[model samples]
Target: MTEGMGDKTEGAERILCDEGLRVAVGGLGDRVVVDVRDGTANRFWTDTSNLEKALHGEAVRIDAHGGYCVIEVREGTGRLDLVMEGVEHKHCDFSTGDLADAIAMVREQSDPEGSLVERA
Candidate 1:
């Protein structure tokens, strides 16, 4: 959390590194927001949820050459399997589907006998 912003924020933390990058992470009610800014013109903001479940120590790696990225939530005890961790899968699966369809996907995954649709 930033110095003066602490009282106004919840689950917030600000990291200042020797590399001169400033990062802010926090939550507002039900959403998590992250901001990254350098002294230059590279400031950016990324907001999402399920953050509290992925804080303290989580990992996000992008494998450009390998063609895939991995994002995992890590707790003090261990890493969490997102499906079982109860994190909402995706807002649209592609972010353009019907809201009901998205919810149905989550509901389908909740079943013990349901088969997952894997990318081919």
Candidate 2:
């Protein structure tokens, strides 16, 4: 092995997204997981440390989905913000058993259909 060379991974990480939309969470640690085909306008502002890191440090961040909607959870923030950029943004205090809502969101967005979804 050459000096300063990292071991190359033969294949990218494969994710079993819900629905029919397949996606992967590359090098970024649960930071920006977007629909590659639909992420042309994607961008985000997150703390240097990622979600897990933020949680560990008790910090929060604001991010948009589809580069359009804002569906996110942050540390020390007792609210959920849903924003449809250039259209609307909503915010409300966290709700009961919200862990369910979160899981449901993941399932719907991950692979709402039954088909082959590739990693980008």
Candidate 3:
């Protein structure tokens, strides 16, 4: 729902944000893709159909290319629970009040050096 992404329709992909970082969402069936590009050749992404369900505290985890990301709703507060394996063996945890904050958290971690600012 970020600015310029427009209203989401059934099965439509949208680029949520593409500033110092790029985040896009799309897919269908039991799949929802959240692709994050930190302005590097390497990218970090996740796809899961359980996101909506997970917002009720049902934790979901996905592993990819020697790393992993987890998403769930925080108990009690119902906040978004996002945990990911970051660069150089870093384990990052983000408890965001909403999806936008979650995306921002990812952008900050994925591009900690602000390398994408110039390209953006």
The top-ranked prediction according to lDDT is 3
- Local accuracy by lDDT, each model: 0.27, 0.31, 0.40
RMSD values for the candidates in order, in angstroms, are 17.8, 12.2, 12.6
Using alpha carbons, what is the TM-score of model 1?
0.28
Across residues 7-100, which tens digit of lDDT does each residue of candidate 2 receive?
A: 2212223232322223222222212332211223233333223423332333344444433322334554433333344634444443223433
- TM-scores of the candidates in the order shown: 0.28, 0.26, 0.42
Q: Write the per-residue lDDT of candidate 3 for residues 1-120, one digit (tens) a residue.
A: 111111221344455445544545454333345554553322233433345545556766644443444455565343221233455322223333444334333333332333322111
* Candidate with best TM-score: 3
Q: What is the clash tally of candidate 2?
A: 9
Point out the higher-scoring one by lDDT: 1 or 3: 3
Worst 10 residues of 2 by lDDT: 1-10
Descending-lDDT candidate ranking: 3, 2, 1
* lDDT by residue (tens digit), candidate 1, 2-118: 111112233434332213333343333333223333332222122232333233345432222112222343333322121112223221011112222322332333323322111
Candidate that beats the other on TM-score, 1 or 2, i.e. the better one: 1
Task: Choose 2 or 3, whichever is better by lDDT.
Answer: 3
